[model samples]
Target: MNATGAWDRLEPKLAATNARVAALESDPSRRNSFVAYTMERDSAYCDLDGERLLMMSGYSYLGLAGDERVVAAAKAAVDVYGTGNHGVRALAGTIPLHEELEAEVARFAGRERALVFGSGYAANVGTVGALVGQGDTVLIDKYDHASIVDGCRLSGATVTRFRHNDVDHLERRLKAAAPTGVRLVIVDSVYSMDGDIAPLPELREVCDRYDALLMVDEAHALGVIGKTGGGIEEHFDHKVRVDVKLGTLSKAIPSMGGWIAGSHDLIGHLRYAARPFLFSAALGPAQTGAALESLRILRREPERVTHTQTQAQRLRTRLNDAGISTMDSTTAVLPVIAGSDDAAYDYATACRKAGVIGLPVVTPAVPNDLARLRIAVTARHTAADIDFAAEAFLTAAAQTGLI
Candidate 1:
């Protein structure tokens, strides 16, 4: 039964996705998703499929993806420490670079200490499972990252999801929960799809009232917000307390791995207790070195954060002014609503044909009627580039009959 009946039972569940993929792949102009980059010209542009399209879908928000300094650090680390570590970090995997990277992350995030994980997904799942169990309660945003949702499911904690960005709904749920075990409220600092920010101050006030610990994932917020790219704290210029702060290194840091920053005691507990950290091999030296260097650059040149946000608004405005709905985005990410799954595919196909590479987010990632093209504008995209991308998007919308 295990061998013969597995796919037979599972294939039906995938029929819709299969059809969507078939339609998506049928387009001759579609080439963005899952394509390997042969070369990167800079932070703003990459060479793919024998063409150099303007990139509107990358996560290097601070323009440091191919910075000479970052590349140099990664190369130097490989020369000294070689390619990989010996074992799991608990045993022989830890390196000087790992310790140095953690310290720098803690410093940059204004936390007492930091613990690094093999990946951001690991950080969330492992930390959540380590922190809570039966009888504990966890509340999360409806639109948080999938990793966060998986973390809650695996934690053995009773999970409650509140409406997206509604603090009042959260308060009501908190009031109704049993007042015995730990209550943790988690959210993303900057929502990945909608690109709106979490109301940190409001969340802190509500969490404090309920004695609930607050956690915020900075995956999309770290390099896109803040005055000096200081993340949620800087974005609001408010001294809100976030008990558990976790984020990924792959996005703005332009490297691999992840880190959880918090009080020294929390870091100490997670270092020894988190299963993902305990079981997985340590982060590679090159990734650690690259992240460290990128962070240093972010510290020295915060204006890049401002530039990225400005260009994002510039693009958002252009699209909105053209009567296209961007749907509540106010950060470097702009969600260009495309109506439905088929419409999203058509929009992306038309978009690629016009020499821009913005990808689509269709159901069930988003509601069917709200399917969209998620365009993330990074730093180093000049005003001209932003204008060009905007016009290209408008043209695609027209071609797809979405306007």
Candidate 2:
């Protein structure tokens, strides 16, 4: 049982990361996805060590991060709850705020019940692992979130990944699999990096044909799509049936947590069986309160979603007209394609110098050849801001030959 040999080999893996860090530090202009910025008055710009840059890589799609109401709600929760609860949800940590937030999420998501976890990562991993195991099979999109991939790997279920958003390929994988205990098909309703909407109707039809349960992660869909920003179902006019609808409270909601909404039975099972939810401490009162208020504001103000989509499309058209590819993006998230990793870095640096902050997305998040700037738009963006960013992107791409 001696592990000295195995421990010795771990140094090489750590050394590789150190090498990458050294490479990045050698060039101050090269970004590595970990930039810090202070967002104050304007959602259109963020301050970096006193330097103001036009923001684009943020996930606050609804532009509610600095809302006075959301901040007041969090402060109120802190005053009442005294920061945190006593224990985990299975015990004393079950605060009234948790129940209220769950109810609001369930109602908003068009489900009968809901459960909250400390983070979106916990929700995905906990739910998927608890729902299927042993004899079950989980078929996921190749481009599903890392948390989903981790959940599948840890579920003790046979896992298979089909081509990304390829319904026919999913059908082929399902047909080729053994008839088993549970067949769960999971996909992101809107892809994070590609910024494209999943073919939900087609996926549902295929899952129905194969008698599989379909789970759609609406992480990037909510607050960015549909007439009312009600997510995938609303985007598709309530036509398709997704057995499980789960999403992060952190993204557009501007809070901190993850949730799944479904029938009462499904939620009930998760409450008792999901280890991360049962064992981990419940979501903090401030985050729960903030999330609740943000959801309410989004519900009341659907026009924000419209403005976000409009600005995104306007920018996309500009990029396209300038001979730059945005891939197939149709949402607030836009991927400005830069041919190589170095080119993406250059594009980001140039864009920043030009006053827009579209950070480069490198390998593993997207294919190496497809490295891009994962620009995100918010409702707060003005026509002038959009024009400025478009001009920056075009000029940067031209200067670097990134097109």
Candidate 3:
């Protein structure tokens, strides 16, 4: 077909999608619903549309994003390494900083070796695709992150999803898979939306019984769980036999990139086989330096982890006392159910008007009935800040008729 004819055929579908988006964005009640707000400062509290709002939906759990030491490290690295690394790691992009960061990550994760990726999504996608393929069976939680779902699809593996956090459902699926091929079970250590933790010890037993390899994504758990922010294994107070550990530096680390930590042989194989690791440009020197400093800070100051968890508990208690529903949240993430998409958006808008920034998570990201304001608590939030946020939430709920 001619170029003009092809354009004519494809234009309608694209226009229809754009029209739907415009309808949602232009609605008076839902305006500014899912739009990103420009942050004038760090995430603790940010200026949005000329109004300063206390950040309640950010993921920098330990408040390391604006830490002077971390920023200084990043600045020093920029001074020495310039801006970009210029090539993929396998070629000329590999630097001493990369090796140093990898070693520190492996040590932090309690693994023999670690491999870094350009981003957490790349880490999951590349690791899963590199480890398993056609004829292999990959089992994942129904509520796993999108990157994990994409990884499973890309691997060409026989993918099956068990019910969310239901070990019995997982066991049933494991029993049905073929006995000859590689059997892998993957789950998030802490579900991002629900804020509930995975039953890691129970899952370890199930994997052992089925002779399956277990992988846990610690994207939200690291620097927020465990005694010293060591992640799921540390949180459980027992070293669960997790075969593969995957996490992102963007959250608690307050930097870019992701990592997969495991046996030396496994990491070595991924270094050559993982497409994302091999083809993607390396993580910037500034990010690596910042992450390294953050990790060190986390180790030296374990109080940050404890303080974050304590504050999360306080927020949940305040919400519950005010008769607001915080569904299944036990970690720094708190979801206040708002019933419907419009209600969730309305609640978030109300919170914003009350001097807090809590984002609404609507349908497609969550179930229709589970739409909520995803509030995130961090170490940076003081007791007074928590109290103020709780008061604002209660007032917003009352104003929106959500209480």
Model 2 residue 331 lDDT score: 90
Query: In model 1, which regions exceed 4 Å deviation?
Result: 5-7, 10-17
Better of 1 and 3 by lDDT: 3
**For candidate 3, lDDT tens digit of each residue in 285-398?**
999899989988998999999999999999999999879878777899999998887788788888988999898887788987788999999989999999999999999999
lDDT tens digits, residue span 58-156, model 1: 888888888889999999999999999999999999999999999999998899999999999999999998898899999999998888899899989
- For model 2, residues 1-403, the per-residue Cα lDDT tens digits are 5798887889799899888667644576665456778886556788887888789888888989989999999999999997988989989998898899999999889889999899999999999999999999999999899999999999999999999889999999999877968999999989999899989999999999999999989999988889988898999999987999998999999999999999999999999999889989989999999999999998899998999999999999998888888888899889888867777788888898888889888777787688788999888788898999999988888788776
Q: Which stretches of candidate 2 lie over 4 Å from their true place?
A: 1-8
The alpha-carbon root-mean-square deviation between model 2 and the true structure, to one decimal in Å, is 1.9
| Residue range with the least summed lDDT across 10 consecutive positions in model 2 | 24-33
TM-score of each: 0.96, 0.97, 0.96
Q: For model 3, what is the C-alpha lDDT against the true structure?
A: 0.90
lDDT of 3 at 45: 80
**Per-prediction RMSD in angstroms?**
1.7, 1.9, 1.9
- In angstroms, how far off is 5's CA in candidate 2? 7.5
